[model samples]
Target chain A: MGSLQRLGRWTLGVLERLGRGHLFLLRTLLAMGTLVRRPGLLLREIYSVGVLSLLIVAVSGLFVGMVLGYQGYITLVDFGAAEALGTVVALSLVRELGPVVTALLFAGRAGSALTAEIGLMKTTEQLSSMEMMAVDPYKRVIAPRFLAGVISMPLLAAIFSAVGVAGGYFIGVGVLGVDSGAYWSQMQASVDFHEDIMNGVIKSMVFGVVAAWIAVFEGYDATPTSEGVSRATTRTVVHTALAILALDFILTGLMFGDI
Target chain B: MTTRRIEITVGIFVALGLAALFMLAVQVSNLGEYRGGDGYEVHAYFNNIGGLKVRAPVTMAGVRVGRVTAITYDAERYQARVSFTISARYDQLPTDTQASIYTAGLLGEQYIALEPGGEDEVLRDGDVILFTQSALVLEELIGRVLVNLTGN
Candidate 1:
């Protein structure tokens, strides 16, 4: 009977947290309505979140693509299908790897930072002081960061895919002696703009919304203490990574499945 | 950072992202090719299509001129009907053009090859080619060879 009571209490606690999270989301979204009037704040946040993370995203994308190209060439050469290396690389990057990897990297880079920043603000009573000064912290702080994250995601994903494709070309044609013309021509013949590229963009956008929402929510919901801030930051990263992966599977099925 | 510096940096980032997308669309995919409309379609019937897929190239004399648009069964005629669109630039094909399915290399994809005949009348929209050759079936050829060998 004691164990049953504990289980019941745990479920209710979870439900209560879920309800508060949803309310926080609603309030943040409403606060975002005034965003057009203060584009400067959003721009600053974009610089911190998106532009600052560009180097890591591009470098990682390059290595990933080069590895794919080298591996693909070796396997395909055995089958005398080396001409298909470009098609294989481009399709995989544009359809699956580009958006998914970018989202994971973004969560690690920007999502955790956003959570930590907001959590620190709370721990220091900055948010409470802003409220005392008749300032709505949601509009002033949370909304800009949230909007910045949401807007930066798709752009970063596009850059990653493009750089990755270049990296693949470098390894496939430059290092492996694959015919340059065949490399690009085959990829052009196979990859469809509307089907693959647009779907990837849509996927990144969805991941951005989810990652930003979770980060901001965890920070706002964190207990006002240093330990609480650290916990919230850790949760933000773990939850965002898991959510991006799970959502990628569901999005891929919906986008690609004939059924 | 100063507001001016942040604004410029963000602007450059956005520009870079857009340029990357442009490269993906134009260089990495066939976005430049006019896929549909602005072209006339012709029909042909085949006994066997054999791995032919939609969007497969439709070539004339080894040069691509169009794309396969649809493949369906003509139950009334007991044949496979294929419809393809020829770019407006290649609208002067003879009405008696011969259409045959050909595979690229031994294991490559299947595509339609059209050979223009000596007819003065050019093929028009909705026109059907009278001479249609079916795709070669390797298994059937092997079966025929086996039958000949055993019989001999």
Candidate 2:
């Protein structure tokens, strides 16, 4: 009886939090009206969230591409289809890995940072003080950060995919002795603009909105305490990762199911 | 001072991201392909299209001249009708051109190959290639071989 009661309580708690999170998101989005007037605020958050996260995303992209090149060469060579190394690498990166991996990394880097920052503000009573000063903290504080995240995500994913493609090119053509002409020509022939590349860009944009939403919501909803701040930060990372993966599955099905 | 630095860094970051997208579109994908919008449509009817798909390259003498645009079934003629577009530059192709579906590599994608014939008449928009060969299905080939062996 007690176990069943605990399960019911947990379900209700989750439902309540989910409802509250959606309300917070709606409010934050509504508060974005002031964004155009204060572009500097949005730019500053973009600098922190997007610019700061570029290094990890690029370096990881390069390594991932190189590894794919090496592994793809090993397997494709067995089939005597080593000429398709570029197509394999580019397709995989743009279609699946680019947005998905970049979002995972962004969750760890920017998502956690946003949560911790907002949680800290709440913990230190800064948000409360802002409330006292007749300033809507959601407009002044949270909206720009959330907007920065949404804006940065697709750009970051694009950078990752481009760098990854370069890395794959270097490893496949330079190190693995694949023909440079075949490498590029095959990729161009097979990778369609609307089907593969644009689909990836659309995917990254969706992921961006989602990652930013979860980050800000978690931070805004955090309990005003030191431990609560830490816990919220952890939750931001975990939730963002799971959300990205789940959304990736759904997006891939909808986008590429015909292929 | 820090604000200026932040603005500059953000500017550079935005530029880099845009540049990356440009590269993906131009270099990685087929967005840079010459889409002159000066192409003429041609149709061909085949016994079997096999794995032929829309947007498959239409090659002439080993050079890509166009792409397959539409694939449909001809209920009246009991054939697979394929519609493709050839760039205006290749407008001199003879009306007697033969269209055949061929696979690249062993297990690669299928494409339509055009073999030019000696004719004064040029293929215009909406003209159908009368000579068409279907894609070679491996299963049918094996079945034929088995029948011949058993009969022998």
Candidate 3:
């Protein structure tokens, strides 16, 4: 019985610490200075986060569009609103699907890599060595990562939305035999500059920032061991995914309500 | 460095992507450059314009000659006020144009179609379109059709 209570206490402490860890990261960011001194690092990190991962995002986006189109077309046909298939695809993809799916893909691809890399660096005392050498690790590491994420996330989302919308068209018109001219026209009419693309672009940049920050924070704090790195990597993906989804919901509410 | 190559590649991708988007955008326009400025404007008032989105095309004799331009519902008047842009080239409608809510098909979107009344007077941009049709929802239409067919 004593052992059970002790075990429960220990579990509670660990959970409490885990909950508090994000606040520690937030504090670290608030204390972070010298972001301006690290232009080169920022540019490089942006490439890694934004550019290297395009192929994966694009492929996923294309398939999502096709599937969304397939679903919307059949559903609209049942109600005789078959002409509305294009608008439905465009509205849903740009407003909701694009930012989310792309962020999830980023979590799988980049978030895990960031966590593992940071965890390994922590274990090796390499970050300490950099600190001892008077190198500002935040400037060299975190700033660039944050900047890169901000840059790349929107581009990735745009690619996702466009591919998805086009996929809808190909599947909806070519495969489903809807008139291509009418399909395109409805899509054009349904979307406006404010409601669709602009909102998506803004949401994506926010997701990028949150996802990268969580991944890096988890990794930077991990202990110096293989197990630590593995755990950090898994946590990075999970946390990033959750943050992206949560942020998506909040931003969608704010953006649409204003518009 | 390898990073430079990545940036250049990404730049190209972004440029190409934007170009593709621009091309698609151009293709999606009304391109109805065929401005037949001979049609008269029509107005409608509805107690409720539920699901009656703007830009829904107005059809006559199974042909689309104009599109809905705007929708404004006056709460005080207890009416949904809508305006449609007709080509000026079509025959001028009399002041007593009868407009009604229409469906594209069984499950189609709701539109406001105008049936010309022989009032010997034509409808202009601000004319109060007489005898308007409100939208016919699919479920309601279906229920009616089914009930009639059942011979009940």
Collision pairs in model 1: none
Listed per prediction, chain B TM-scores read 0.94, 0.91, 0.67
Lowest lDDT sum, 10 consecutive residues, model 1 chain A, at A250-259
Kindly report which residue stretches of model 1 are placed more than 4 angstroms away from their true locations once superposed.
Answer: B35-37
TM-score of 2: 0.97
Query: Which tens-of-lDDT digit does each residue in B1-152 have in candidate 2?
Result: 49999999999999999999999988988877756765899999999999999989999989999989999999999999999989888899898999999999889899999999999999999999999999999999999999999999
lDDT per residue, candidate 1, A121-187, as tens digits? 9989999999999999999999999999999899998999999999999999999999999999899
TM-scores for the candidates = 0.96, 0.97, 0.73
Question: Model 1 chain B: which ten-residue window has the lowest total lDDT?
Answer: B30-39
TM-score of chain A of 2: 0.98
DockQ of 2: 0.88
CA shift of A31, model 1, Å: 1.9
Error of 2 at A201 (Å): 0.9
Residue B112 error, candidate 1, Å: 1.5
Error of 2 at A246 (Å): 0.6
Winning candidate number (TM-score): 2
lDDT of 2 at B41: 96
lDDT of 3: 0.75
Off by over 4 Å in 2: B149-152
